[model samples]
Target: MDAFGDGNFEQSEIDPAAEFLAREQNALAGLEDEIPPLPTGPVDDDVTQPKAEDGNDDFSGYTVPKQVTEEPERIRKWREEQKTRLEEKDREEERKKEELREQARKELEDWYKHHEEAISKTKAANRESAKNAEKQFVAETDEIEPGTEWERIAKLCDFNPKTNKSSKDISRMRSIILQLKQNPISTNKKV
Candidate 1:
């Protein structure tokens, strides 16, 4: 506390933001006094300036200048809109594809249903035809009499001759009896 000056020099240091603002003000003041040189050659069309042919000093025909450091809000909004449009198109395409898949699935199921119905109808027709054939075969076989050449084999096989059309076993016996009637030599063989 016995020093010649106050020990508070560190607290008096200037803020960095204030120093920067002071420098920026001095630079702007210097630019105000000086005049910018006119471009010699043909100026680029993209710069924000009035047309030389119009000779007007107002802001007409002057496009807003773009900064190299920052993007405008309009471009960002346009980009978002484009992205949304593309996503919507993709969703629509996916929905169409799903619809096509559903249509194909329905068609396949219908085809299977029709095929099953056709198969059932064909099976019923086959059964009817088989029953008709069996009836025709039985009618043709009824012409063979009891005491004909069929009786000899029926006697050897211990079967009754009067009941030839009685049961399934008798029907099979009648078929064997008819085969024996055709082949005379096998009739003498024992069962």
Candidate 2:
């Protein structure tokens, strides 16, 4: 070696570089010893949250799932009440109609039994007999009067309003008289 005097680099010069590499490798190994080891198998996932036992809660006071409700029971009860009310109303209407019908039937029966004897009287439909009329209906009990009760009652009960002539109109007076003569009830009776 031209030693330090001349420009020659020998094995000794390269030895320091090798020593530096070895020291660095040892330091790295030491650092690795202090580090945690890598897992070789699947990590455990058995973590579980405990349920509230003593009923005590954490910071947010343990929010539970919200509950839902239905009002079908209430609605069903309301419907039942409404149905009962409606049924009662219908019954009342029927009772009123029945009362009116009975009164009419009694009046007719009395009239027929007394005046229209021997003949089985029948009913006819007439516009005059409509319950909604603004005027009081009157008729001759003994004679066949125009717009009278006997004729009106006969036509009112026996005739079909859909086809019969109007009682107020005079043109149908002949048909009304003829109709009374042809009536089975009047024909059957002596009067």
Winning candidate number (lDDT): 1
Write one digit per residue (lDDT tens) for candidate 2, span 1-191: 55578675444645787999999998798787686654434433442333557765442322233345677998989999999999999999999999999999999999878765534232223343454343433333345554444555555454444555655545465566657656534333564
Top candidate by TM-score:
1
Those runs of model 2 whose alpha carbons end farther than 4 Å from true positions after fitting are 1-71, 117-191
Pairs of residues clashing in candidate 1: none
C-alpha lDDT of all candidate models, in order: 0.73, 0.60
Runs of candidate 1 exceeding 4 Å displacement? 1-74, 144-191
Candidate 1 lDDT over residue span 88-154, tens digit each: 9999999999999999999999999999999999999999999997897677568655445555445
Per-residue lDDT, model 1, residue 186, is 37
TM-score, candidate 2, is: 0.23
